[model samples]
Target: MDKSTEEKIYEAARKVFILKGMEGARMQEIADEAGMNKALLHYYFRNKENLFKAVFKDIFTKFFAKLKDTLLSSATTREKLTVFIDNYIDLITANPYVPSFIINEINRDPKVLSSLMFENFMEPAKVLKLFFNEVESANKSVVDPRHILTSLMGMLVFPFVARPILQMVLFQDDKVAYNNFLEERKEVVKNMMFKLIEI
Candidate 1:
């Protein structure tokens, strides 16, 4: 099957970035990997940083609307949590690069994620407030909103972030088995977090 120009560029960019790291990667290399010229790559993405952000945002924009809606809705913490875990894990499994892309950007520049989340993704305050509001609501299992927020996020994202090590150590580098573990994690995480928060 043929790939679109943007898809080709994204795939090429991801490969180059992985091999050389973002700072060391060059657009010419990505263009070469994509079987295109530098000018054509520039036509789609003006610069390396732009290309990088475009790649990540392409995935984020697809899911941000649903995430925003669930976070902002007046649903109980349990209800919102179920939706969040389901959608989030679905996203991670579908795009395994999503978590690493985010973590790499954060590592590249600490403030980058803050900028991405606050300015690009959604206002940080509203997300933070979602947790606090949950505590105030009749379902009061979420007293430590900040802790819950960080813990839930860590729980959801850690396995993917640590996939290489976990896959090697826990599953003897069995890719399919490791993936099954992650898939099973959806229900496991939900049940464990619910138990923790008593929500």
Candidate 2:
């Protein structure tokens, strides 16, 4: 129950939950990962559900914090687009399991998804609304910001989420090629968004 011990437990739990997902992760795995005893792990979290929820909440918090800073700041539209694409790509690439983890958990208990939306936790939709408003005012262009945002995120995220299939079909299991493609996406996504939105 010291701070360092508590931090260790949380960090271990996060890795386990993200890797195995909520239903698949076992408390023993988390305990082993933390180099702690089951009793002590229970002392901190009391149950697997509680521990998973804590880790999931932390993940959501970190995600929202990054997104809010990117979307809400007073950067120019181009700057914001670059920031959004860069931050989103970096986050998904680094935490390759996160998008699927969230989707799986929410699928199991849809109420959790609703709760996140109701609580306005890093509300991507709200951010899109603001960006759309700006785009309309700036150019009166016909582009839908929501569509653009979805396309950008899908382009950035789909490959990582479907890496196994893409590897077999597209890259012939060439990780080097996949990585190079992802790196190129950093610029490709930015250019695609700018072209779609710029006046």
Q: Give the number of the best model, judged by lDDT.
A: 2
lDDT of 1 by residue, 91-142 (tens): 7777676667657766877764554575655564677586667644633564
- Please give the lDDT score for candidate 2: 0.79
RMSD to true structure for each model, in Å: 3.5, 2.4
Candidate 1, superposed: residue stretches over 4 Å from native = 1-21, 43-46, 53-65, 72-74, 114-118, 121-124, 135-142
Query: Clashes in candidate 1: how many?
Result: 0
Q: What is the C-alpha lDDT of each candidate?
A: 0.75, 0.79
**Candidate 2 lDDT tens digits, 1-199:** 4658778899999998888988889888888999988788889888888787778877977876787778887577777778877888888888888887877888888766565565555476677678878766554456676676677778877888788898779899999998888878899988876677765
What is the lDDT for 6 in model 2? Answer: 76
User: Model 1's lDDT to the true fold?
Assistant: 0.75
Q: On a 0 to 1 TM-score scale, where does candidate 1 land against the true structure? A: 0.76
Model 2 / residue 64 / CA error / Å: 2.3
